[model samples]
Target: MFKNNNTCLAVFTGIIGVVFFSAKAVMVKLAYQYDVSPVNLLMFRMLFALPFYIVILFITRKKSEEHGLGVKDFIWLLFFGFIGYYLASYFDFLGLQYIKASIERVILFIYPTIVVILSAVFLKRKVGPVQILAIAITYVGVLVAFWDEFRIEGSEFLTGAGLIFLSALTYASYLTGSDFLIPKFGVLRFTSYAMIIACISVVTHCSLSEEASLSGYHANVYWLGLAMAFLSTVIPSFMVSYSIKEIGASNFSVLGSLGPVSTIILASIFLDEKFTILQMGGTIIVIFGVVVISLQKRRKHT
Candidate 1:
C-alpha cells in the first residue's frame, strides 16, 4: 500500500512539475513582447527566485550537516549549477526569442533521451534493445514536430531549434551529474544550494554582459518575471527534484513528456499560437514513446 501511494505521489508530482515547467516558455515568450532581452529576463527571474532558494538553504542547512557536504561536493554543486540552471536556462530563454513556445517545449523534451544516452556512455549503464527502440521513437517524433515547424517557418527554425537542443543537452548533463550528487547531499539541500549557485552565476553574467539594463523596464515585465520566478522556477524545480527522488530520474523524465503537450495547449490559449495537424500528431507520438520508456523502467524495477 505504501509503495502504491508513493508511486501515486511521484506521478502527481511529476505531472505538476512538468506542467509548471511548461509554463516557463510561454511566460518567456510573453515577456519578450516587452522587448526584454534574454539576459535581462533571465537575470530578473533568478533575482526574484534568489530569496526562495535562500530560504530553502536555511531550512535545509541543519539537515545537510547530517551528511556533511565536502569541498568536492560543493565544487560539483557549483559546476552543475552553472551548467544545469544557468547555461541551460540562458540558452532556453534565448531560443524562445526565435521559436514558438510549442516547438521550444518539444525540443526540450529530448532531454530524457539525452539523459539516457549520457548515462549509458558516461556512467557505463547498459542500454538494452528496448531502450534503443524507445529512443528512436522519441526522435522520430521530434523530427515530425521539427518538420512541421520548418515547413511553416522556413530556414529560420534551425537557429532556434539548435539553441533549444543545446539547452536540452546542458540540462541532461545537469541531470546526469545530479543523479550522483542528489544521493549524497539530499534532494532539498542539493536543490537549494545548487540553485543558489546558479543564481549567483546568472547575476554575474548579467553584470558582465550589459545586454539589457536591469532597471527601467515596464512594470508588466517585472510582474511577468516574478511569475516566472515563482510559478516556473522555484515551484517546479522542487517538485521535479522531489519527483526524481521518489521515482528515479529515468521514470521522472518519462513523465516529462507531458511538458510539450501542456506547453502547446498553454501557448494556443495564451499566446494564440497555431498548430498544424502534423505537429499535433508528432506531439502524440512523442508522448507515446515516452510512455513506453516509462513502462519499461517500471517493469525493470518491479
Candidate 2:
C-alpha cells in the first residue's frame, strides 16, 4: 500500500512537471508577440529564475559539502549546462519564432528517441528490437505532424523545424550525460548548480549578442517571462527531478507522454493555434511510441 501510494504521488508529480514544461513553448510564443528577441527573452527567463537557484544552493550547501564535489564535476556541470539549458533553450526560443507551439512540442518530444540512440552509440548500450521499433514509430509520427506544417509554411517551416530538432538533439545529449552525473551529485543539487552555470552562460551570450536588448518591451512580456521562469522553468525542473528520483526516469517519462497533448490543448485555447485531425492523430501516435519506449526501459530494468 505504501509503495502504491508513493507511485501515485510520483505519477502526479511527473504529470504536473510535464504540463508546466509543455507550457514553456506556449509562453515563448506569447512573449514573441511583443517582438522580444529570443536571446533577450532567454536572458529574462534565466535572470528572473536566478534567485531561486541561488536559494537552492544556499540550502543545499552543507549537503553538497558532504558529497564533496570535485573540480571535474564542476567542469562537467558547466559543459552540460551550456549544452542542455543554454543552447537547447536558445535554439528552442529561436525556433518558436517560426513554428507553431504545437508543432514545436511534437518535435521536442522526439528527444527520448534521440537519447536512446545516443546511449546506444556513445554509451555502448544495447539497442533491442523493441527500442528500434519504438524509435521508428516515433519518427513516423513526427513526419506526419511535420507534413501539414510543411504544406502550409513551406521552406520556413523546415528552417524552424530544423532548429527545434537541433534543440532536441542537444537536449538529448544533455540527458545522456546527466544520467551519469545525477547519481553522483544528487538531482536537486546537480540541477541547481548546472542551471546556475547555464544562467551565467545565457547572460554572457545576451551581453555579447548585438540583437540582445533589455529595454522597450511591453509589460505583458515581462509578466509572461516571469510566469515562464517560475512556473515552467524552476518549478517543473525540480518536480521532474524529484519525480525521477522517486519513480525512476522510465516511469516518469511514461507519465510525461502527456506533454504534447497538453501543449496542443493549451496552444489551441491560448494561442488560438489550429490543428487538423491528421495532426491530432500524429500526436497520438507519437505519444504511443514514447510510451512503448518508456515501458521497454522499465521492462529492461525490472
Candidate 3:
C-alpha cells in the first residue's frame, strides 16, 4: 500500500512495527517488577487480545466469502498459533524471568539467522557469501550487546539460553510456514484467526496450570501488559505478515535482523539502561554483517 512502488515501504513499516514490538520488553520488565508471574502475565496478555482477534476474523470472513478459511486453514493455524505464539511467547517470558533483558534480546536475535537457514532448507532459497556474512554480523552484534551481561558458563543460563533460542526457532518456523498463508488468506484474516487460536491455547494452559487470570497486578501493570498485546503482538504480527506478502520471507527476514539493534536502542531510552561503547560497537558490526549477508544473497540471485 505504500506509494513508493517499491518494497521500501514494507521495510520501513517492518522496522517501525518491530520497534513498537520492542517496547514490550520494557513493559514486561515493568509488569514483572509489579509482581506478576509469568503465567498470569502471559494469560493477561492473551485473554485481553482474544475478543479483538475474534471480531477481526469475523469481519474478514464476511468480506471474503469465497476465500474464507476452512478446516485445513484451522488445522494449520492451530499448529502455527500454538507453536509460534503460545509456545514461543511462553518460552520468551519464562526465559526472560531467568535471564537479563539484554541476554534475552541477544538470544532472540538469533531468530533472523534461523529464518535464513530455514529458508534455505525449506524453500530451497539460495544463500550467498554476503548473506552468510550478514547473519554472522548480526549475531556478533548481539553478542557485543549482551556479552557483559552473560558470564559464559552455567546450567541455568545455558538452559535459559536454549529456551530463548527455541523461542526464536519456533517463531522463525511460523514465519516460514505462514508466508504462503499470508498471500492466500491476507494478513488480517490469517493473523486474527491465528492469534485467537494462540490466545485460546494459552488460556487453556493457564487455566489448567495456574491459579488465576490477571491476578496480583497493579492497574498500571495490567494496562502495560495489554499494551504488550497490542504493540508487540498485534501490530508487528500484522506488519510482518504484510511484508512477507509484499517482499517474500527472505527479504522480510533480512530486515528482521535489525530487531536487536533497535531493541538495544529502545532499551537504553525507555528502560533507562546504559548504552556502553562496547554495545554500540557490536551493533555497528552486526549491521555490517547483515549488509554482507544481504549483498551475498543478491549476488547469488543475480
Model 1: pairs clashing at backbone N, Cα or C within 3 Å? none
Candidate 3 on 77-169: residue-level lDDT in tens? Answer: 779878988898988888877766666777787777677788889889877665665666677777776676665555688878888888888
Worst 10 residues of 2 by lDDT: 248-257
Write down the TM-score of every candidate. Answer: 0.91, 0.86, 0.88
Question: Ten residues in a row with the worst lDDT in model 3?
Answer: 293-302
* Candidate 3 regions with alpha-carbon error over 4 angstroms: 1-4, 66-73, 151-155, 288-302
To one decimal, what is the Cα RMSD in angstroms of model 2 from the true structure? Answer: 2.9
What's the C-alpha lDDT at position 14 in model 3?
A: 68
- Candidate 2 residue pairs in backbone clash: none
Write model 1 residue lDDT over 144-204, tens digit each, in one string: 7557555577566789989999999999889878877888888888888778888999898
lDDT of 2 by residue, 189-250 (tens): 87897789889999999888998887889999999889999999999888877776665443
Whichever of 1 and 2 has more lDDT, that candidate is: 1
What's model 3's overall lDDT?
0.75
Q: What is the Cα-based lDDT of residue 280 in candidate 3?
A: 89
Off by over 4 Å in 1: 66-68, 142-146, 153-155, 296-302
